[model samples]
Target: MGDIQAYLASKYMSGAKADAILSRSEAGRPKKKKRRIDQAVPVAVGDGTGLLIADEDSLGNGWGQAEPEEEDTDVPVVTAAAKTLRLKKSNWSLPSASSSTQPEPAAEEPPAESSTATATSAPPVKKRKGGLLTAAQLKEEAEALAIEEARKEAEREQERLEARRRRRAEGIEDDEDLANDDDDDVDDHPDHQRTVYRDRSGKIVDAQAERAEQIKAEAEDRARQAAKKDWNKGLVQRNQREVEAQRERQVASTSFARSANDRDMNDELRNEVRREDPAAAFLTQRKKKGPQRPKYTGPAPPPNRFGIPPGFRWDGVDRSTGYEAKLFQKINERSRKAKEAYQWSTEEM
Candidate 1:
C-alpha cells in the first residue's frame, strides 16, 4: 500500500514541485515562529470602550459576552494599555472613513477630556481662498495703510518745516553777523569815511549815487550790445535778400538766353528748308483754299489693249483687280456665245 501511494504521488508531482519539496525538506522546513500573546497587554479594537478582555481565547468568543479581566500589575502593561486606549479613542472620534483603513497614529496620548473640550469649544477655522483675505477685509486693510502713510507723511512734512525754520533762523543770524562785520570794516577804513557823503537833509546818499551810476553804465552796455546784435541781424538779412535777388536775375538771364537760342534755331531751320526745297517752301507759304466740289465734265477715256490708260501704262493697274477684270470678260464672252448658238439652233429647228 505504501509503494502504491508513493508511485501515485510521484506520477502527480511535477519536477519543479519535487525540487521545491526537496529543497524545503533539506532546509528543515522553517517552523513558523509562534506569536507570543501578551495577555496583560489589552488588544484595542475599533470600538472606543476601554473594557479589557482576558486573552485570545476569550477574544474569539463574542466581545459582548466576554468578562473584563483584572488590571495588570506591571507598569509597562498599564502604559501600553493606556496608549492603546488613547489611540482607539482618537480613531473613534475622527470623522473620516479612511481613518479605519489607516494604521493607528503613533502619537503621544493626550488627555481625552481636555482634547474633547478643546475640540468642542473652539470654532472650526474656515479655509481661506488662496490663503487670502476677502475683498471687504482687503479694502479696510488698504484704507488703514493709506491713513498710516498719510500720518507719516504729515509728520515728515512737519519735520521738514521745522528744519526749514531752523535753517532760516541760522541764515538770519549769519546775515546779522555779516552786517556787523561790514560795519566794523566801514569804521576801520579811512577811505570809506572819506567817500561817505550826506545830503543837506542829513540823509546818507553816496551809495545810492554810486549804484545809480553803475546801473546807468550797465544799461548803456546792454543797449550797445542790443544795437550791435540788431545791426548784425540787418546785415545778414540784407545779404540774404541780395543773394536771392542775384539768383533770380541769373535765372531770368538764363531763361532769356535759352529763348533767344530757340528762336535762332527756328530761323535757321526755316532758312535750311528754303535752300533744300524752294517749291515745298512756297507751298508751305501758300494760302489754303476753301472746300469745293469738282465739275462733272465727261466720261473717262477707254483703256488700251493692255487694259491701261495711255498715261498709266508704266503704272499698271493692281494685279488683284486685273485678274478680276479678266475673269469678268471671260464670263461675258461665254454668255454671248451661248446666246448666239441658241439663236442659230432656233432658226434651224
Candidate 2:
C-alpha cells in the first residue's frame, strides 16, 4: 500500500499510467460497500428522455437487467441511464468485467428515527408531487365542502327555531325580523332535486299533498280559537255570580253580631261600632220618643271587693249611677264614725 502510494506520488508518472494504477486499486480495494436497497431507493425513470448516464453496469444494484418483453428495449436502457445520472454522486461499485458473479440489490431501509433499522444512516429520500392541489380532486372536494357548509347552516336555522319556541314559552318576546326569517329555498327543497327513489312525478304529488295538509291545519286552528272564546264567556258569568253571593253572606253575618252586642248592653263596644258607622241603627242606642233623662232607682250597693274607693260609676246605664253614689256615702259615714270613736277611747285612756 505504501509502495503504491509512493509510486502514485512520483513526478515521473504519466496520467494514463496513474489512471490504470488507480483503477486497479479500486478493483483490489474491495468493492465499495454495495448500495443496499435498504439504502438505495428505486424510482421509475422516463425513457428516451435524453437523460445522462455513467456505464451499463455501474448502477450499485443489478439494475441494468432487461425484462422479457423486447419491444421496448430502449425503456430499460434509458431508465437505467437516468437512474445512474440521478445517483452517480453516491459512491457506487461495479463488478470487474472478467468476474462471473452479478451483484444483488440489497433491501432499502428508511431513516433511523422513524424506522426500525439503519440508525445513523443516510436519511430516506422522498419524491415530490407536481403541484399543491390536483385538478379533478380539488373540484370534487370543493363541491363536498360546499354541501357540508349548507347542511351546517340548515342545522343552525333549526336550532334557532327551537330556541325561539323555548323563549316564547318563558314569556320573552323575540325581535320580529330575526325570529321570522324565512328558510332559504335550498332548505325547503333539500332532497327534492336528488330524486334517489322517486321519479319526477312522485315529487310533485308529495308536494301538493303536503300543502293541502298545511291548509287543513290552519282551518282547524281557527275553529278551535272560536270555540275557546265562547267557552270563556260562560266562565266569566259564573265567576261573577260567585263573587256577589260571597258579599251578601258577609253583610248578614255583620247584622247578627251587632244584635248580640246590643243585648249585652256593652256601651263602650257599641260606641266603637258606632264610630265605624255613626248614623247606623245597629250602632246607636234606641230611644222611645221621650224628652226627659231617665232617673236612677236601685238596691243598696254590694261591697267593693278590692278597695277601689267606692264611687266607681258604671258609665253607660243611667239607672246604676245613683247606686254607686249611695255606696260611696255609706263608706264615708262609717269612716267618720270610726274616727270619732277612736278619739273618745284615747281621751278616756
Candidate 3:
C-alpha cells in the first residue's frame, strides 16, 4: 500500500492527496461497518417523459453481492418519495463482457398528469381500451357519465321553465314550445318512426305485450262507454215514462173543471173567455189621461239639458216670476244633490 501510494504521488498527485486516496481506496482501507444491502435505495431517472426506476444493473455500476436481509419483526416498512445519491470515485472492476445484461429504454411512465391519472391509479399495466378498467372503476365511470348527463338535462329543464315563466308573465297564450325535446320532428312523424316499447323500469319490453296491453285498455274503455250509454238510455226512458204517467194523473185531477175560464187552464186557453175591457174601464182611462198633451210634427229641436219642453223656444226673456224661480232653483238643487249621492255610491261600488 505504501509503494502504491508512492507510485501515485510521483506519477499523478501530491503525497498528501495520494495518501488520502489510498486511505479511501479498497485495498489499504480500514474495515468498514457493514451496511444492510436491503437498505440500498433505488433512484428514479427522468427521460423528458416521466419518472423511471433506476437500479445498479442499469449502468454497469452495482454494489457487491451481500447477505440476504434479516426478517423484519416490529419495524414498519417505509417508502421514500425520492432520494439523491452522489457517486464516490472508486476502483471497481467492470462486469464480464460476454455475460452482459442490456438496459431497457427510458420513458416507461407517462408525462401528462390529467390524461394518465386514471392509468396510474389502475392496478394493471395494460392501459389500452378496457383492459385496465376494473369492475368498480367501470361502474364509477358509468355513474359519473350518467350524472353529467343528468346535470345537462336539469340545466335544459331549468332553462325551459324560465322561458315558460317569461311567457306567462308576458300574458302569452302558448301550449307549444314548452319543450323542444318532445316537440321534435319525431312527434310530427310518429307513424314514420319506429316505435320502441319500454317497461316500468325503463327496460325495453316486448312490443306485442305492450300492444296487447294497449288494446286491452282500449277495449275496457269502449265497454265502459257502451255501459254508460245504456245506463243513460235507461234513465231517459224512465224519465219519459214518469212524465207520461204524471200527465195522465194531472188530466184525471183536473177533469172536474174542463171549461174555458178554469184557473188551472193555460193562459192561451183562458184568454178565449177573458174580458179585456172591464165594467169600470171608462173610469180607469179618465184617471190615466187626466190631461191631453199636444203633439208636434216638426223636426225635433236640438235638445237642451235644462228641462225645457221638446218644442218650446226661449224668447230671450226671463218670464219666470221671482217665487217660481226660487222654487225651481230649490228643485234643481235637490236633484243635483241626489245625483251627487248616486255618483258617490257608484264610485264606492
Candidate 4:
C-alpha cells in the first residue's frame, strides 16, 4: 500500500483512478521494482529536530553566486606598457568608452550601368552652373568638351590645309604668309608714294598708285598667258543666220531697183521696205487705243495660256485634247468594278 501510495502520489494520480486501474488488472501482473524508502520519497521528519547545516558561502565546489557567462563583445583591449628591455614590447591603455564611437554602415552604391545611363539621360551642360554636381556628370561633360574641341580644331586645320592645297593646285605659291613680304618691303620705300619719275604726258609714273597699276598689269599679263589657248583655225564654217540676213538685205535693196509699176502697185509694200509699218492702208491691225476694261476695279483674274486681256475667261471644257474620250473609258472601268469592293485587276485578276 505504501508503494502504491508512493507511485500514485509521484504520478499525481487520484485514488479513484488508481483503484479503477487496479480493479481492471489481473492478479498475474508483474511485481513492482523495489526502491529504498529514503531514495523513493521523503517521509515525515521529527518535529523541531532539524539537522545542523553549514553556511552556504563556506561550502566547497559550487558555493556562492554563480558568475554570469561573459558576453562575446570581442572588443580589442590594451594592456599596461611592459619594460622595453623585454622581447614583448610596450602595451598601451585601453581607449575610454566615451572616446569609442559606433561605426556606421557604409552606403550602397548604384550600379556602374545606372550611373552611366543617368549621365547620358541628362542634357549636356556647357558651364557647370551654380549647382552641386556628380563625378559622373563632370566626367561625361569633360569628355564631350574634349571631343568637341578636338573636332572644331580639326575642322579649322582642315580648312587651312584645303586653302594651301587649292593654292598649290592652282599653280601658285602655297606660302601665302610670305606672298605679301615682297610688297611690304617695297611699299615701305620713302619715295614709293612720291612721284619719282615722269612720262611724256605728265603722268605720275613713280607714285604708289602707278606702281600698283604696273603690278596689276603684270598680274593681268601673267593671267593672260595662263589663259592663252592654242587655237589653230582650220575649218571655214559658214553661218546660216548671217548668210540669210545678207540675202534679206540684198532683197530689200533690190526692191528699189525694181520697175515703178511693182513699187507703186501697193503703197504699203513700198513703204514697208523703207522701215515703216505699211499695213495702215487697208487692214485695221492696231486696236482703237483706249483702256479696254477701264482699269480693273478688283483683283485681276489669273492669266490664260493665250495672250488675251486679263478679263477673258474661257469655258471649263478643254476640247483640244481627247479628254472626253478618256472620260468614257474611265466610266466603263468604274462600271465594270462597281459590283466589287475594289478593282480585282489590281489584285487577283
Name the best candidate (by lDDT): 3
lDDT per prediction? 0.61, 0.58, 0.62, 0.57
lDDT, candidate 4, residue 42?
A: 15
Give the alpha carbon lDDT tens digit for every residue of 200-264 in model 2.
Answer: 66643455667799999999999999778777577778689777798678656665545554643
Clashing pairs in 2: 37-106, 37-107, 37-108, 38-107, 38-108, 38-109
Q: How many backbone clashes does candidate 1 have?
A: 0
lDDT for each residue of candidate 3 in 183-252, tens digit (9 for 90 to 100): 6766778564767778789997778887899999999999999778767567788789789899789878
Name the weakest run of 10 consecutive residues (lDDT summed) in model 4: 35-44
The sequence of per-residue lDDT tens digits that candidate 1 reaches over residues 188-259 is 888756766778999887777788999999999999997787675667787897898987886676644456
Write down the TM-score of every candidate: 0.15, 0.15, 0.18, 0.15
RMSD value for candidate 2: 28.1
Candidate 2 residue 128 C-alpha distance from true site, Å: 16
Best by TM-score: 3
2 or 3: which has the higher lDDT?
3
TM-score of 4: 0.15
Candidate 3 regions exceeding 4 Å error are: 1-131, 173-349
Ranking by lDDT: 3, 1, 2, 4
